[model samples]
Target: MNLIAVYTTLIVVLLIWIGARRNPLMALVEIGREMLRSYKFILIIVGMFSVLALNKYELQIERKMHLAADYTSFVFGLEGHFVRHVQELFYAPWLTPVIVFFYIFMLQSVLAASLGIYLLDKNRVLLYATCYTIILTYAIAIPFYLYFPVNEVWSYVPAGVKFTMLEVFPRFEQEYRPLSGLNNCFPSLHTAISVSMALLAFRSGNRRWMVISGISAVVIVFGIFYLGIHWLTDMLGGTLLAVVSTTVAVKLAKLTLRSGEDRLRVRSRATHTR
Candidate 1:
């Protein structure tokens, strides 16, 4: 058995046990019922995934567009060199673990939010909101990635600054890029999604989850910069995109809920008349 798989299973089991302390089986049954009732939620997720997968293939179309190297360079100007120095100051063997862990955690926020908020807290609305925000981040970021190819700071290494984060996790970096796809650095989807996760977590009533996701978001914002993966302007763009995406997602969710309620009310009235 894979140790990580076994460990994850045990943790989930423990949570289920506690969540349904009086009757674990009944708790699972109730969860099943809820899932059946919320089947549309699953469809929503499927739709989002479909869009992301399409985005990957669509990136080939992006190559025809000109690189915004001059524009991206103008974005940082002298500040890029200054931040590079700041990044170097923190580069050490000791800091590698936290940086790498947080970097991965930032990417995994969607999974964490789904499990943490939906399963642990049992709030589907918050869960969907969190998920949609991440989805929307990708939706909005894709166009920029297609047209505005801002090279990752690391690409500028020998000229301006060293690529600090990748240096620390060279093997992991080498392995991750094939799957992650390079040349999509503008607006930092990592930053946007992490921020959205933090926002959703905080809005959720669960203070513990909020604190954890909030901390993760802050670390990721700093981490991307420290790692030399994003320009400071990219962080700003990501943040703004997050806010817009979350706002739109929440509105659309409310509209969907309202539409469902209206349909249900009409059916109930018709049945009673019958």
Candidate 2:
């Protein structure tokens, strides 16, 4: 079996083991539940790996579908127009990575909040919403990556322009290069994930967190464009995905709750009668 298949099997086995520890019947149910919760994340990770594998093994496929040249050129042109303005406004030598780090950390924070709420009494509404949003974002993003794979503008911009910006934020540019990829720029995952966290904060009744997330999203969106990591269109796509994913997650969570509640009621009655 391929690595994908192997990994999928391992995940399934792990879930089963986790479920069985609870009780055989409960374990079976939990396996299904966990699969529903986690399948989207798995698929997204798989899609990324598949892209990497294909690039490694299939040059022809990469050449045919590659949007690197066009996307990079477009972003370069856009950045050229706004680069100076952005630098004047927010291009601090030390603040760029701090902002980026906070953006990533917010994702973890949102995940923790969602999990905490679920553990505190199983708020299916929140649980479903969070998982569904994450899955939906992955689902939408994978297709965009396949169809409109774009490299970061840093890959192809003129050396003169690159060096000028690098001078202002040398450390920021260097630190960003290792973590940010050239491909996967059509729909900015940063924006998508940021919006996801913001929406989650809103849904979970953390108004303060929502405000912080909103501000962070705005900053990250600016950072992405100003840094030439993504185009404006990519940010728009991320926003759309965030909205759609959050909506779907809320709906799915509601359905799951209804089903779970109905099952529990029936089980309780049966136990009483016995």
Q: Please count the clashing residue pairs in each candidate, in the order shown.
A: 0, 0
What are the runs in model 2 whose C-alpha is more than 4 Å off? 1-70, 74-80, 158-180, 260-274
Q: Give lDDT tens digits, candidate 1, residues 31-72.
A: 465557776667776877887786767555554554443455
Model 1 per-residue lDDT at 29: 56
Candidate whose lDDT is highest? 1
How much RMSD separates candidate 2 from the native structure? 10.1
| Model 1 segments more than 4 A misplaced | 1-35, 63-70, 259-274
Local distance difference test values of all predictions, in order: 0.62, 0.54
What pairs collide in candidate 1?
Answer: none
Compared with the true structure, the alpha-carbon lDDT of candidate 2 equals 0.54
If scored against the real structure, what TM-score would every candidate get? 0.76, 0.60
lDDT of 1 at 263: 26
- Write one digit per residue (lDDT tens) for candidate 2, span 25-68: 34345435655765643454355456545433433444576644
For candidate 1, the C-alpha RMSD (Å) to the true structure equals: 7.6
